[model samples]
Target chain A: MNDKPLPETLLPLEVDGVSFRHRGQTLLDDVSLRLGHSGKTVIMGPNGAGKSLLMRLCHGLLSPSAGSIRWADGKAASDPDVRGRQAMVFQRPVLLRRSALSNIRYPLALRGMRRQQRTQRALDALRHFGLAELADRPARVLSGGEQQRLALARAWALQPRILFLDEPTSALDPAATKAVEDAVRAFHAKGTRIVMNTHDLGQARRLADDVLFLCRGRVLEHTPAGRFFDTPSTPEAAAFIRGELVW
Target chain B: MVDGNPFAKALELILGLDQVLVGIVTLSLQVSLTAVLTAALLGLPIGAAVALYRFPGRALVVTVLNALMGLPPVVAGLAVYLLLSRAGPLGSWGLLFTPTAMVIAQTMLVFPIIAALSRQVVEDLWEEYREQLQSLGASRLRAIPTLLWDARFSLLTGVLAGFGRASAEVGAVLIVGGNIDGVTRVMTTAIALETSKGNLPLALGLGIVLLFLVAMVNATAFLIGEGAKRRLG
Candidate 1:
């Protein structure tokens, strides 16, 4: 039901020479990549590859130690509208302790939407996510799958131009993972750009329009989904594709 | 020193609503409530600031607060006494030997209790909500009220704890209040005066009332906390 026309700004998400360091040790080296305005771009990397950190940097939740991240035609990511136009869901869904209804309403409230409109919007989101019956329940008491669905509903209700998800289904069972995959597909269908991180190669293959393979904080390969699986350019990515440790 | 059992006589005073007993109880509530309310007004912001922001000397501020939580009531009373004394810096206000001075002393006694406890509560809630709220576009300062509201049940316990401390304290109020008969005496001070004068029944009666008052406050806080936990969480 996303009839609302997309915003005019088509500034591709650009990460130019971004690096992050903590305690005098580099976590992400001079990594750079550009993300298109649509479809699922799954970030696949082994443990400690800085996948989540990079997603955070892209979402404007964290700043890089060096280099720049810009979105929407050179628009500063800190711009209120820019920030408002994107949302992120972490590995563990962070729902408010309020009712499921209120969890979605909170971000709408933050957007300063009027009570009547936001309430209806939130209710609609709950219905859309098959959570309408549980709307009155405390969000924290929901099942993991339900909580993840609620988190997605909360982000989707914001009508974000882009959604960043970090290992969204890492902790889910098969059925729950499938449910989450369906929701992610719905977001993609509605034309919301999806940039996600996952350790699940099969899930990545299923949902990814493209793959950004990272190894030890470096982008080993960023290629189309079909090509990445068939012929990864770097040995690190090839080894990772074969389920072997790169380092 | 009494001809009759003091406990029975004390119960009679309470049941009969003795004027002196009532006066002591009323004054005790007034002074302690004012003190706790003032302390909360000052403490909540200080507690929130310490929890939500990082700065130089933060560790020292927290250390002093933790230490102040256990500050002896007598020392606080003495400090307030000097401040309100004729030759003291605040002497011109003429607050010494007045109820105002006792309120000042109790506020000083419990401000740290409220601040320290609230800082802990708010800090824990902030830790849980920080990244989520920041991603939602709430700056650290903007998130304080939200975090405070969400942690309100815990913060209410801190206030109740402050009230308990202020109400039960005798040393601070006694020094600055002077326990003036029919003037500035509160429950704790009146009980002390009565005991010193060998009026065991009256003192014991006031002590009973003080204990009951504290129980009621703590029970009410507990019930509200449970209700909030059930309703909000």
Candidate 2:
């Protein structure tokens, strides 16, 4: 759906020796990974395994205390061009205290999209996500499912090259989870790269192209979805796949 | 002995629509409203800035603002009087003993209250909105309008509190306006004057009108807040 040519590609995200510390405690320790220009990569780990923290680091929400995260074209995350090409949806769906339409319109406005064009794009995104009727409703008051979908709609309006989902459906019911998963597939179908975190193995199996398994802030495995599930490389990964607590 | 009940007389004066009473009421509204509008215009941005930015002495500034919210009206009036007196720095403009001087005094008294309350509201909102706005590429400065607009309902209560302070205080307006007849005279000063002169009926009427106006302002704010909550929620 993105007819306009991109200014530059932002793929092949390279995380080099990235580490994060908080209050003298290291949360992510010497983590390094390379993401190429494709696939829905699911980050699976037990609680407190630094899955969300690592995603946030890659999305530029939080800076690493050590090493660097670089895009393929060398644009810094602080650059507006790079920021304009990425979006993140938090676990709780941080909707604005505004109408659903305005929530979608806000980022477009920040990107300097014209009023008429932004409104048109926002409406198309809402319609695409099947939220056309609730466009005028206050975003914060919407049901959990609707709010998450609206969050997706907002990200969709941005036409992000990469989308980060941090446990997006963890708080939703089964029906809502299904809707979010479908929306995630929709984003992937449009050629947007997806990086997500989930504790739900079934969800991981359904959506993951590759799985990155983590235990205690260390990456134990990064393999294709099938191989990672069928034959985990590390003891931690094996215990995790067997539904035993590893952390 | 007074001629009749003060309440009955107040109702009579109000129902009769006496010209002097109307003038006093009109002038009181003009001065206080002007003061509130001016204070809000200046204070809101200051409050938002203090909430969003972290500079040296920010904590001290916030503490000073909170302390200033309790500034005595007479002290504020005296401060303005000194600034506007013949020997004072701004005396060249000769605004002393005028309606504008009264407005300045009241605005001075009200600014701190608005600024402090708005700072608290905006700070709380910023905490909730920080991550989402940052992710959207909005700088702290760019997020101001959104934060302010979202905090509008709470800010309205702060403005009303400012209005209540301005309309109720006689010390500041009296010192600055000199209670001049048909000129700088307003409801609070006129009430004080008529009471001392044993013109109890007029004083009581002004008091009743002032109370009614304050009630109306509060009711309107409440209804607006409730309506928005229901509709938006």
Candidate 3:
């Protein structure tokens, strides 16, 4: 982890009253939240609860049909600087059809980092993720766990201020899941705000500082991980905690 | 008809290294390869742009390109011939009845095939890669090279398909090249000329060679594509 502070932090992400509609149907309705510059925040919900949709809206991959998402200093997610300061990892680990080293170097190159420096940083990232041996190998051919780890290493190379992961370990085995969780912890330790979406209650309990629970398209509860787990807040959440299906 | 079996004579002509047969084969390869190269240079980017960008009339453009993939070689040759004729728009170059003119005609005939096939290929790749590349801060323009590179093997098959069209067509080259004895007599035009002149053995020999060449090109492309797909994926 680079201990050097980012020049400007895009912290305190404020998503206010955002609604996303597709065709005639609403997918994420009146989603609102504020996240400061710390801790792991996991968005937990049942299937089709709009957890992934909300994260996409916040990450600027999809725009909300209604309201706004602003970072620190009122910068919109569309701001290039804000976008440059954040990174995302998808569930299936979308690695470029290139060597693992090049996959890590790609975003750094896009940020206009010079060749030598970006290569060194990419190599360091690969080493950090225990992927140094796979550096020259094509990324798409790697085992699923290694590919996801490479995805994390690629994110690490960016040194993002916030990392959004959408069910990143949904397809992984237990060992691979542990590796991804450890990588998430390392990112949080380096002060990168972690906003993840997952339906796994055990994972949320293990990693979330605050849990944003949703049922249908609405946020049911936004409570600390402890309280969200211990107390019965919403019936949907309680049912979810008890391993029962909601919606 | 020749006295011996046509296939035996054709095989003998090929193995005997007849100068005329070799020359025609070489010129055929040179012209078609050059035309395919030119078409790829122009068509790949055009296809990629069509795939990546959203503009007015995009559907119309795609439709036209797809339709043009089945364009008649003679029609393409006639268009080039008209352009290069003495009183036509590009007549100042005096490129009529030349190998360059054949190259131009074949390029015209092959461009749409390459472009339309590549558009389909790059479009599918773009669909798969769009969100991830966008997340990495890659604009659509910047993503073109990456998409093209990642789709290289598939695009190579497109280029080879264009080459196949160019090499196998007789009408385009015959019209523009005038089938001149040494200067512009490619295999297809020579086969047509020889057959019309009642020289069955020579025409059959050229036909055999042309079939072999096209088969070899396709085989090579398939092997390379499969090998690289395994290595990269």
lDDT, each prediction: 0.87, 0.90, 0.90
Task: For candidate 1, give the lDDT.
Answer: 0.87
Q: Residues B117-144, candidate 3, lDDT per residue (tens digit)?
A: 8899999998888888989999888998
Q: Give me the runs in candidate 3 sitting further than 4 Å from their true place.
A: A1-4, B1-3
Chain A vs. true chain A, TM-score per candidate?
0.97, 0.97, 0.97
Candidate 2 lDDT, B1-233, residue by residue in tens: 55557787778877998898899888898999999999999899889989999999999999999999999999999999999999999999899999999999999988999999889999999998887888888889988888888888889899999999999999999998999999999889989998999888767877888898878878988899878977666
DockQ of 1: 0.56
What local lDDT does model 1 show for residue A9?
Answer: 80
Indicate the TM-score of model 1: 0.92
Q: Write the per-residue lDDT of candidate 2 for residues A35-121, one digit (tens) a residue.
A: 988899999999999999999888877899998888887766667767778999989877777899999999889888889998999
In model 2, how large is the Cα lDDT of residue B95?
Answer: 99
User: What DockQ results do all the predictions give, each relative to the true complex?
Assistant: 0.56, 0.69, 0.80
Report the lDDT of model 3 for residue A102. 96
Ranking of models by lDDT: 3, 2, 1
> Model 1, which residues run further than 4 Å from truth?
A1-6, B1-6, B85-94
